[model samples]
Target: MSITTLERPAAENDGDGDDGTGSGVGTDAARATVAGGEAPAAPTRIPSKEGVEVGPRRRLRESTLDERFNILGALVAGPTVATLLFGWFTPLTGPIGWVVVAFLAFIGFYILLVSLRSDREEVKDRVLTVLLISAGTILFGALAFVVVYAVGRGSVALPHLNFFTQTMELAGPLDGLDVGGISHAIVGTLIQISIALAITIPLGITTAVFLNEIGGKFARFVRTISDAMTALPSIVAGLFVYAAIIQLITHQRSGFAASLAISVMMLPIIIRASDVVLRLVPGNLREASYALGSTRWRTVWSVVLPTARSGLVTAVILGTARGIGETSPVLLTSGITAVMNLNPFSGPMISLPLQVFDFVKSPEPNIIARGFGTAAVLILLVLLLFVIARLIGGKGPGQLSDRQRRRVAQQSVDDLQRIAARNHLLTPSPAPTTQESSP
Candidate 1:
């Protein structure tokens, strides 16, 4: 072999090793010789430590006792505890034990149904929803039961017309007495609520309108003030009215004073209600009115107000209901009296709440029963007001008169079709052909 041939073989071996193109031991051996004198050794592997398996019974017992107790403890210590305590113990065993037990039983059953584990997500959600609804229903029922119990206990004297007309007439301890009617209290409640509505509605509606429709620095300020008013306590309202209108403005306990106090109590509610309703009015209605060249004020007055009129009325009615039963404010401004007084500007006023308060204080069982009867009547009156408000004010002309809505809908369809035709959006009916033309 020549020198060239020997160098050629060495270059080929080096190229194979450098390029890592050869799988033969020649390349591997060359590499090993160049890097060191010997090949590298493989890494040592260590064995893993083994664990002894527990019996199935022990494993299951551990899972059940540990996880189940953990979860159960969490639930018992959480909101569920409150529910059980309130639903079972507070209402059932104390003053109103029967009501509490029933409430708790309902809650427990509902919780059990909801707590059932399921594979279906929708089913689980639905179960939870049903449980919540059942709980709410139970809670409400319990509350109603308590109210009914109190009222029923108090309503023993309700059947007699005298209950409505009578006042406290308990004279001697032995010879239990007969009282007069609650006509005065009834009159006072009506008068105070009416005045409260009258004072609150306009002020509230205007304030709400300004806040919603006319947003500016001043409007924002007014809204902030109204929000503050919403949190004011009834007692505070009474005190304010007592200090300002009753003592400072005029030093006499009269229906007017009571009205002023109630008005104060009602103002925030009406403002908040009207604000919510006004805000709910569709922006499209406002824009449509503006498109017709209507002024902002006119558009708001005619279109927006009318559209939200039902809701606004409901708000006012709700506010009135809230103001009607308040005793503290009325007590501060209008001293309690048995005689009926309709005039708001003069004389002491007796309201149902005040009557109930008075009777509950009496030691006689009959008077206490009378208080319950009064409470029931008060609740009835509130319900009546709600119903009337719905009938008269909440139902729109369209809803109240189905025929009118049908007529309007029919007229709208005709108008739309005519417009569509005028716009060439639909093909006109084919021209009629004479019978002779059939030839």
Candidate 2:
């Protein structure tokens, strides 16, 4: 037999020097073809950029600090420049016009800077983000200003312990802030709100449940009416109670009458908000409860209400917030009196809002200070109510505190053990097998 040695073309192996071993399987195949006395086929080479391995690239992350600084610097610089330019060129006296101009300038400058580096989509996103943040900042700033102004103006009265403890009955409108207090107003406000909540919470929640669960033609009509009533003016609500109950039945203005008016104002808000919240309850929850042989009411109580409990509380709180600050209704229904009147049924009562209104209308600067003081007190009371509501509402559905979780686990264990015990009792023991061979 003749020995055959495979050799590759010199041109093919120019850059990649052959060290006896083939470059790859393709090189070995080409050599084999040549050794077989057939013309060697050209090897296929993979095309690639020198010293590069291509793959997907990762996106860059945001420079949060730098971006924040940029935004802040723009806001400051734009406002300052606009104010200076407006003062030099025009006779603009008010800060409001200057602020508007500055805001517009800031937005334009920010967008221009963003467009330099970012694409259209990114620029749009940044612009929207800045606008939203600016709006939020303005809103919070206004709120802070109000609170600060109230507290500062009221400090004249607030420092006196008697301002919280004593009544305004003995003190004249011109009396010093240290002499009189808003004790009656505080008491009246609480009593009226409590009564309103007592009346509205049940009726509103039931109405919402009716709208969502037993919806029909009547339900739709009720829903439409409630929706319309949400926009009803406070004075209109007071007038309604005045006509319906106060005039026809009571024949006098009282805290009870004021509660009726407040309830009227609050009912629609509660019903509408609760209805929305209840609708958000997952259908699967209701279906699961039914699958377990639960009735509609039982399912609502055990599963649905618990699931939406937090939201329901929020609805009630919103209603309270809306009604709490109402001056017109309280002024109309509950006649203002400086002296404390505890009786909600017979005598005239005055709430914080009414007290504030009465005080502010006075010509005395001291009385005006008392009005701000009352307003400050009202703000604090609202904040306290909010905190209380949050605490009472507790955890949302499917969320349990550590202690609650342990209790539930223990209860479950007890139930499982009871079930196992009952099954053992129901299941008969096998008959004792006889010793067949022993006999």
Candidate 3:
């Protein structure tokens, strides 16, 4: 049999040396068709550039000049019209009523303005954005009001340095702010919270780990119990401690009892929060560790814990905040004391919340000021705790601080050196290099 060689047509494929479609499959198929082989590929249609923009595309999210004008106009006109309706025509009285009407009118005007020049989607988007901004403003305003109101009212007491140093043990209800301090309450709070944290952290984290890593029917039962405990009232926790530990065992209210009650409130919160954080650890991390011959516990300790450290700290902060601010539990479990009680197990203890409660009960202005001052102190303490926790474990997964990055780089260098040393030990004489090392 004689062989036949396939060749390309001269005119059809000058630009691409194939089909002008810029595909080699077309050329291969043509040769195949000539030699009685595969079918030719379908020709591709090139896209038209008739109306396509070569300039930088406009960003959809950037606000137009019209939108800004509309917003400004609506803000001015809506409130103006609302003020007229309230003041000129309507019998509506009070700044609050006027403000509410003005806000409603503003929303209406905003939507009307946005709808005037934009599509239904853009109008909806603008309305949603305004609603969100309004919500954020309300939340921020409420927070600021609470903080300002507390600190402002307390400012009279806060300036006195002795307010943080002296205790109410020697001071009477009619005594001046200079006579009494919350030092005992502050110390007691520290002790109670430290104890509660000690008990809560290990048990909560272990329970959470059990729920996530070693789950079973028992874990589900535990989770359900934890969920129920989250809704448990502070009074109930105090009563539980009072009934079981005080009446049966200790026979008196003390900081330890208060701590136990706080732990009851904190445990569920920490467990539930920690469980969520631990669940977010990727499954592949476990698999990777196991593939490298790590035990389940070892993998969880090294891989899972490190990965979820930041979230775990957040969980702890939530629990701490919850437990620290609880008044009812501490009140019922820890009988209030004016004198500092360092021994958590022995005598009655008072915390900032309890001190505030006691101070407010008295009708004296000095006592009231002390109450507000104590509350402000509690807020500051919580804020300090939050700041510390954030500093320690604020970084999310795959995020490293400058210090951490440097540490990691150093560790990598150490690992490389160790690996090289091991290779040298295993095989005494070094093998010839494929290429000389760069200086």
Cα-based lDDT for every prediction: 0.71, 0.86, 0.88
> Per-prediction TM-score, please?
0.65, 0.82, 0.82
| Whole-model alpha-carbon lDDT for candidate 1 | 0.71
User: Which model scores highest in lDDT?
Assistant: 3
The C-alpha RMSD of each candidate to the native structure, in angstroms, is 19.7, 12.1, 12.5
lDDT of 2: 0.86
lDDT for each residue of candidate 2 in 1-439, tens digit (9 for 90 to 100): 5411123333334434442224444455566777995645534443335422122233346466656666877777788878887888777777788888899888877887777777899988989988898899999999999999999999888989999999998999767877989999999999999999999999999999999888999999999999999999999988888888788999999999999899989999999999999999999999999999999999999998999999999999999998888888888899979898999998799999999999999889999999999999999999999999988998788888898999999999999999999999999999998876965
lDDT of 3 by residue, 1-439 (tens): 5411122232445544444333455567767888997776554333325421123335668888988988898889878987898789887788888778888888998898888888999899889998899999999999999999999999999999889999888989887777879999999999999999999999999999999998899999999999999999899998999999999999989999999999999999999999999999999999999999999999989999999999999999999999999999999999988898899999899999999999899888988999999999999999999999999886998999999899999999999999999988888676787987899
Which scores better on lDDT, 1 or 2?
A: 2
lDDT of 1 by residue, 1-439 (tens): 5533222332344643432222244566667878878964422322224321111122322344433543454445444555566676565335355455544554464445445543467445644665687689889988899778866686566777766765544322233324455667787888888777778888889988889988899998888888898788888888988898878867888888888878887888888888988888778888999999999999988898888888888888878887888888877888877666777787787788988888788787766776788888888898888888877675652364676678888999999999987878566777998776554
lDDT of 2 at 351: 97
Q: On lDDT, who's better, 1 or 3?
A: 3
Q: Model 2 — TM-score against the truth?
A: 0.82
Off by over 4 Å in 1: 1-117, 120-124, 166-179, 396-400, 403-439
Q: Go through the candidates in order and give the clash count of each.
A: 13, 0, 0
Give the backbone clash total of model 1: 13
